[model samples]
Target chain A: MTTTVIEESFRPGELEVRPDGTGNLLGSRCRSCGAHFFPTREACAGCLSQDLDAVKFSTEGVLYTYSVVRQSTPAFEVPYAIGYVDFPEGVRIMGQIAGLEFDEITIGMPMTLSLEPFGENEEGDPLTGYRFRPAEVTND
Target chain B: MTDVHVVGVGMTRFGKHPDKDATDLGAAALLEAVADAGIDPRIIESAYVGHVFQGMVTGQRILAQVGLAGLPLSNVENACSSGATAIREASLAIRAGENDVVVAVGTEHLTSKFSGALTPDPSDPEAAVGATMPGVYAMRATRYMEDHGMTREQLALIPVKNKANAARNPLAHFRKEITVADVLESRPIADPLNLHDCSPVTDGAAAVIVMSDRAAKKYANGRGVRLAASALRSGSVDVTPTSMTFEPLTWATAQDAYERAGIGPDEVDFAEVHDCFSIAEVLRVEGLGLFEQGSYPWAVERGEADINGRLPINPSGGLIGKGHPLGGTGVAQVVELVRQLRGEAGDRQIEGAKVGLAHCRGGKAVGIEGAACTVQILIR
Candidate 1:
């Protein structure tokens, strides 16, 4: 595990983040059928169209549903709030809600995607992770 | 469409086998199946191989080891249902007149992928932070308990019963029977799901030989189990996204299978359902309409699903006892049903079994249930 900032333009297998530091999610737009995906793909899963355009998504969304996880596993942190957020673009993303008590998180809470620094790996490497933060965060 | 019959089924003992690779175990099962069917390898017209986590061209890798030559080979991966999906495809190909005889094989070497690390989804930022499979099922267990007043002891009974059944199965991964107290005493993987409630990471393979009705009558010994229906359905994304609730996909698939076979759930003598987690067995039993909602645990407690019960469930011990090798589980379930329908399960066999159902549900993707839910009905 190595820690380095990703500055070059790149296409993730599922998602794309713009270089403007705006934390907007990126997806592929099917030029033929206008189908959108959260994690952009090279081909349109709907129309099988190869002609696609990379598009940035709105950073803001509303919580669709959530679960306050009281248990932990190798896959996720324990005692965290995880849920799906519905963006205006008709795409839903599964993510973690930050800066809220497990009991405080509710359905339809306004949230915005944010880039936060995750902790080190086993070899002590820094990692940056993303989460859904309350819309009214003072720092942002 | 032409009918297809499963003439022979074979499965390697399910457990941690550090000595064998995926192909090695796959070929072992294939050999056993071929011998069981008393057919030469050359009789197989094509092969459908199912695997997950194995790299690209897994079918080619496995079949090549068995000296298979140029034939239509397709690799399938549908998460947990990969095995049954492969069987369905192979059966369809034979029915379509593309082949006279087809081999369906599924193998998993999970020991290679058991590294204790977060498998973050590259596409979902939330997945990057952490969301494990156990956590998702735990959420479901929590919700089910809260909604149905189900107890942890009730959930624990699933493994207790399955392990007891596994004790009778030589192919089971864990042959030791456990009590509900033992299940509750085990280490917690997630809230309400102790280590005993979860299926072990296993390495195994299961194969079945499916032949067209014409070929079966000509070559098979008239001992083949008929495949009445094989249906796959996916969950509806439009519904409220909740892991704990029963999804429509399972119901749709079960109904499709039942209708295709012209039989109802009441006609099913026994079933082998996906019990990746103990709570999942509860959901599947309810979702399949075998028992009323919120009555699965009660049914188990009353031995309604026992091997001697009116409607036995998981007579082969399910994923909990038989072990979920992911890709091999679905096919293994079919193998068990075939054995029961043939009256060959011995002590574990359901008495006078005629119609058997095998239901498998895979993991979730994008907040929905598995990408595929498959149900297959077999009749003697």
Candidate 2:
């Protein structure tokens, strides 16, 4: 008999992992000023309104800027492409760029969020995290 | 309100200190400051210390090491702006008539605390996504280059200029001059920012003695330079996506300093703006209104920012060339300012320097543009 390990979301509040392997990043949308914040906040910074609603962010975004990081902390491996992506909800999110060589990534490219294995949980279970890939590559 | 004057300043040689810890460095700097002021240690009414990664009550330990353990003391931590914040707190004590003489000290043993690229607090959302300090600055450099059409060669000039300045500073971490080609060919830490562009992890400390106007008249012995203004501001959460190349927090803090000092940016004779990364200097001076937007790179090529030029910037070599002991960086900037104003800077002195400016901005949160920023104007 073969046993399969179902992956859990690395951070349940930030990412939701559906049983079908499709999920969305979570954030807070200010009901008063219509502003969005990543990882959620109790009150809106724009208008200081506490009437915030948890919402899932759209996966597609435009690459604003990026860098090939050669040196980093111990947890992260070397030479990863990291970037800030501008979403339609007027928020800029930072993530690792996946599915492309370091030199091939460019500014203004459309990117889509891709859920992948992040690391092992404390109990040694597989955990899922997100990275941004080229939108066209996501289709492939 | 009483005017505040920096009667004396002291700083440790900025470099790796494998044998000494933060407490040792802090005590040495504090003693030097007291001696430089030529005052009895008993005259010091209070003290404030700034540091990061050093454990609690570090200020008390420094005071105890110096045998002044009983006075009221507070430890300050504002990331890289920690030392600058301590100075501001000391100035406030003088201005409020709460103390006649106060000492501000900033010390850090960064080499022992961290190595390689520094990151934000582990809990930050960006840090969770693998954001390192070098990576963040490199991304900004990329955006700045695209927005202004700045060449990579032009960017290389910044480290070259700073290292040459550092060669003249005996206390700097790197005392050898480097060429532009050296900068271009150095090991890459992050794309567009070579190893030369990043400030080294260093161990050091700096101290300043601020006195009330009355105290300066009695003990300053004609060596005091007026601290015209010391302004500090924390970054506000962005209401909207802002430009990555510009720094609004720097501008706001500088505006406060300029207003308090009744001085404009044009009157600045020299400056010691934080150059934690090469691109940081361009952002700082422009944000302070000392240079035009997208104009610093060309100005640097023309020698407009040299020690002998119209507006000398980072004459103490800045963080890139001198060293960056996160807590000590801000206080060291003011020490350079005081030395220049008093005409005591032997080899790297700006001629007839009357007014000097020092700026420090540090820390990175998830949504904030910057953590804390400080601008100080000193006049002779």
Q: Point out where model 1 deviates above 4 Å.
A: A1-93, A97-116, A119-140, B116-126, B239-243
Can you give the TM-score per candidate against the true fold?
A: 0.82, 0.97
lDDT of 2 by residue, B70-126 (tens): 999999999999999999999999999999999999999999999989999988878
Interface RMSD list for the candidates = 4.9, 0.9
Task: Give the Cα error of residue B125 in candidate 1, in Å.
Answer: 4.7
| DockQ of all candidate complexes | 0.17, 0.75
Number of the top TM-score candidate: 2
Q: What tens digits encode model 2's per-residue C-alpha lDDT throughout A23-97?
A: 888889999999998779999999999999999999999999999999999888888999999888888889999
For model 1, residues B275-319, the per-residue Cα lDDT tens digits are: 888988998988999988888898899999889987888988889
TM-score of chain B, per candidate?
A: 0.96, 0.99
User: Could you give the DockQ of candidate 2?
Assistant: 0.75
Model 2 score (lDDT): 0.92
User: How far off is residue B119 in model 2, in Å?
Assistant: 0.8
